[model samples]
Target: MWKSGAACSATRVGVATIITTVFGMALADALIKQSSTAMTLWQIYVLRSALVLPILLVMARGRMNTGRYGWIALRSLALVLMYLGIYAAIPWLELSVVAAALYTSPLFIAGLSAIVLREPITSRHWLGILIGFAGVLLIVRPAASGFKPLALVPVGAAFLYAVAAVITRAKCSDMPTRALAVWLNLSLLVTGLAASLYLSRTGVGAGFDYPFLFGAWRPMSGRDGWVIVVLACLMIGISLGLARAYQSPRPQVIATFDYSFLIFATFWGFVFFGDIPDRLTLLGMGLIMLAGVIVLTAGTPEPTRLEKAKVARDQPLVPCRVKTRTRPQRTDTSPSNR
Candidate 1:
């Protein structure tokens, strides 16, 4: 009974960690949306990355190593690409639509799990995947009159983001959560620098006048600048918190917490941008959230097929056999002999 209570407590703690991560992530997105109007997304990315370095260094506190540096770099690159794709698409799509589209990551993760993790997909999981894709359609609606094809960018990002999450789950198991957190922040910093350089070279330094840079340089108000800085700090916190939480529990359990982001996204959109999601977007996002909830509750780790098959081979097929003679079977024969 005590053990049961303890397990329940641990589950509750895991749930709380997810809640914290989701809210932090949602707020980070909201800040990005606000800052996008006044600052280049590239600038925001650069500023956020620069601001996070000190925090991550403090968090790392001397545990950094040369080993696995390449993997860390790879993870960082994937994350930067994921963010860049999502941010670029937001201006072209509704905030809620983008959020819902990106959150469809669980569906991608499911497919990746089957291939990379060798996890079995039950009928329910398949159904969830179908429902999730349907949800995406409702948001993007390529069939709709004059729908923009660019809206697919976030969906593409969602796939990449799912891959990153799977990699984190697979590769970071042996590394310190703090170490991974710090490395990811550093990677983002590097990615930001690269983006800035590219922009500068193209004469699209930062602003609406720059068009694709979204202009060469739109100066930000001091207040908005501070908000961007605060948001960067929040991003660091969210990344660190998520890394630590996954270290303590299964990804399946952690994934459920993602639904919380939808709620926060809706609330923040309304509060910060006066953005209200239309009925279709709300319906789609609800389905996406439901899909994530179901996927997490299913509790299957995404593993490569090889590892799964190997594990299966090692399990006992049946209980050990014990041969014995029954005394009753010999009684009639004994009586006849007597």
Candidate 2:
């Protein structure tokens, strides 16, 4: 049993981690939206990435995983594109609408797991999947009159983010968290640098670039610049907290808390962007949450302790592997020996 103090600390960390993750992400999105007005999406990514890279570098010393570095780099690159897509859409999309659209990622995970993890999906799972898709359609409202061509941005982003999550779960499970964090920041840095350079050449210098990055790193600016700097730092902290949360807690539990992001997003949308979600948006969000809960609870139970021990003893834990290998080899070798 955990001591009282330890338990309290754990609870605090869990709550703080969730709150920070949600709030920081919302603020970052808002900042990117605000920055997008004055700067290109690439410039915002570069500045935000530049703000976090040095700190990640210092922390990753002695923790880097050379063997798994490639996967880490790939994951980070995917994230760069993911954020670029999400943030770029912000200038044209409602904050609540974008948040609702991205939340459809869990549905993709549920579907992808059938192929990638070989898990048996049940009938209820299908119901949840359909419900989730309906929710996305409601949020997107393509049939409505006001739909713009760029409204599909969030859908495209959701697909890429889903793929990124699957890759993180399957391929990068063993990657060191610190090393993964470092690689993410580094990859963002490279993308940001290239983007900043392009914006400079295209004569978008102040209009599409940060007013300061063109030689003068800090010029006369309003509080907005400071807000961006602070929000960028908070984004790093929240991301680190999320990495730790995923590392420590059982994934199901952490995933449940991830639902809190929707709540926080709505709250921040109102507070920062004056986005008051309509009844339809609330209903759609509720359905999406229901789908995620269904998926989480439907996960297959892990084997019992006895079954685990049996597998550890090198016994035939699953009969299919034995039959496949033994019968094939016996038929081929039996003829040769005879």
In the range 1-338, model 1's lDDT, one tens digit per residue, is 99788766776777788788878887777777766667777677667778877877787887887377767777767777888888887655666777788888888988898899877887677878888888888878899996888789988898988888788777756777777777777776776667667776875544444343444345778897798788877877787677656554355666677577778878888888888887887888888888777766664546689978998999889887898977765445566687
lDDT of 2: 0.71
Score each candidate by Cα lDDT: 0.76, 0.71
Tens-digit lDDT string for candidate 2 (1-338): 46777755765677667766877787777776765545555555566667777787787788774576566667777777777678767877777778777877877877777788776677777877888888877777788897676667876787777777878888887777777777776777787777667655775565533342332222315665676588678867876888876653455666667777788778777887788888887888888878877776675657678878886997656655544545544455576688
List the RMSD of every prediction in angstroms.
Answer: 7.5, 11.0
Which candidate number maximizes lDDT?
1
- Where model 2 places Cα greater than 4 Å from the true spot, the runs are 1-12, 202-222, 301-338
Which pairs in model 2 have colliding backbones? none
